[model samples]
Target: MLKSRLYELSLFLTAVAIAFSSSEILADNTSFITAIIVFWFFSTLYFRLRVFYKNGNTNIEYGISYDLSFVLFAGPLGLFILETIYRFTVYFYRKWKKIADPNEFFDTFYNIGTFVITNSFVYFLFQHFHSSFQSFPFGYWVLLFILVCISSYISGAIMVLLFGTIGESITFKEGIHFIFKDISFLDYGKVAITNGLLFLFLQEGKWEMIISLFILNYIVNLSFYSKSQSIQNKLERDQFEQMAYTDFLTGVFNRTFMDKKMEELNQTSEKIGIVVADIDKFKRINDSYNHAVGDKVIQHFAATLKGYLSEDDYLFRSGGEEFTLCLRKRDFSETADLINSILRGVEKNSVEVEYNGEKTSIFYTASFGLYFYKINELTSIEKAYIQADELMLQSKQRGKNQVSMVNGLITKELV
Candidate 1:
């Protein structure tokens, strides 16, 4: 999910680069450099998405990349002005300033708007300059270069703000500090290679350098992508293991594991109780709002039971609208109240969820048929289960939303 989002931001930048027709100066640095940068964004996005598919998630260098992109933008006049204002107030007149941090100033809506407007205008300016002044000398391009850098930083910083923290504490000095602090030779190699290729294309007018840079960037991104994918795959495998024992709807253990666990519990203890709990008239809920809402209710109820149960207590999905709990105990009567307490907590829960677009809330009551017994009384685990199951039916028959007991008499407590 995170990678998908990061990729989306890159795509947006690529579109903007295209919109301004920043790739017109085939004879100069503008066209090839613009193409390379756009490619970088797209390739990064592709790598991220690819990683997401092969693995689940990854830790990315958001701050480093954002700061790099911001440096690219900060070279422009817009951030220069903001930085000038920041430098003046924070550094020159540190005593008089209401906001002393450049980061705080950068995060303001005004700075954000300026960044956006200037970025757009700067791209428009580049398209105009590249088209109108493609033959302009390198000595005369310093002003435009500054503008483009600021635009790039604005675009990158805004992108960072969209996905990450941009706080008052994050200053230009801090950003520069981090640029070197976590310096990766890999990134330096990329920068060197990028500039080398661009210089070749511009200074030496070698068309082949463009292709070389493209390949180098792709190869570099691919290496990171493969490493990220391995991490993602590991995360997914762990998630699968978790889900195998968990309910998708309610985030609890599913019925299969619950039943198997009950058998294990029966083996160790002479006294054990199996409570098969079902939500009363559950179909009504699914019919009234939607299955999604019903699912939310189930999830909420399941979570409630899970929250209230002891570590030794185990719960699972028996089926739709049904749950099975293995109540392990040496004395059936002694543990009955504990189960009752958990039931009361479930009754008290209300589920809140969003379905389609609307928010919905629901509360449900459950019927519990608990089979209590000593391990030796029943023939095998299966027979012991059958006996307990029979008693549960008795409880269900007597009341739709109440606990029925076997091997010991117990009263239902309504909380």
Candidate 2:
């Protein structure tokens, strides 16, 4: 945290210094500078061409600003002014919108600081290249292309540092991979071409044409940005829904989803098999090893059950060390066969857990109580669930690892 703050402060101070030192180069025509700043500010606000990617825990969101051309034309003073105005405007805009962002405050400073410093660096390079190469051997277009690529590379580095500020530690290899993952050479060429055109019109004092070109670019960018945002919103909704219904540790449907599903099933006149299964001597596992090992065992048990499920079957972690299986489109005999096979599979498989730096296989068993019945108006799913749970308790009382139903034990013994 301290390091991040220091880095931000350094960048901010350096940018301010550069802006102040270049005060002499303020454009003679104040109106041109004003127009540039206004366009740049609005472009940053409305035009965002963003690409999203996932690299492990890091979510890399890359936006193609294409503002480098204008920045180069504006110089240090203009760059700093534009960045400051845009950052502050965004900060206030979010506040007005009642958006609760934890990092918004730091982000405001970080963004302005980073952009000012980076663009100033790029501007310096542009100036150097322009002076050194009077008539470029490889042509000016190729030179612009190379500069844009270099700018992109630098931007990626700054993004990595931003991640570090937020406490996301990534390795150098991962950083490099992140930098190049979604970036296209074609996009870099687009940046070069656009900037070259903008620079040409600016030199010829064709402000109206420059405005037209910027408006065209903005329209194109807004279209793509809208599509990207829509896709991103849908993905976020799906992820949120999954998280709501899924057990955090076991990766199965949680009790909340089970209840909702049961309500839906009760509305139908279909026969469903409800199997309530509980790990035998589960409390002992937590006491003997640790909660971490206990969690491992639970995950392994859930995976084993999941492997046995067909398309018509659903498994849920209804309680701690307890799971519920709903078998649709299966008769009593078929359900019995499946449950018996699961019982045998549980006995055959063992979970490997680490204890005191030593790995050991822990063989365990589970008891199940199945209630096969057709959903009707007379019997509510809540009542049926209670009946299934009571039968599971009966299995627990009958000396642990066995399936008990209304008729009695399916098997004489399961060890």
Over 202-269, each residue of candidate 2 has an lDDT whose tens digit, in order, gives 66767888778777877888888888789989999999999999999989999999989988888898
lDDT of 1 by residue, 1-415 (tens): 3443444445444444443343333333464345445434543343233321111122222311211222233223322333233323333343355434433332333332434355555545554565555465662254344444554455545444443332224556655543344435454444434543454454454546655655665677677777887998999998987878777777788866776666676566466676777787788988888886887777777776677567777788878877777666447766678668766777776777777697766767877777665555334445555555665566668876577777632422111
As a whole number from 0 to 100, the lDDT of residue 244 in candidate 1 is 85
> How close is every model to the real structure, measured as TM-score?
0.43, 0.66
Residue ranges of candidate 2 with Cα displaced over 4 Å: 1-31, 43-67, 71-145, 157-171, 178-181, 185-197, 204-209, 212-240, 267-271, 281-300, 329-334, 352-362, 373-400, 404-415
lDDT score at residue 368, model 1, on the 0-100 scale = 75
Q: Residue 169's C-alpha lDDT in candidate 1? A: 41
Top candidate, metric lDDT: 2
- RMSD of each candidate? 16.5, 6.8
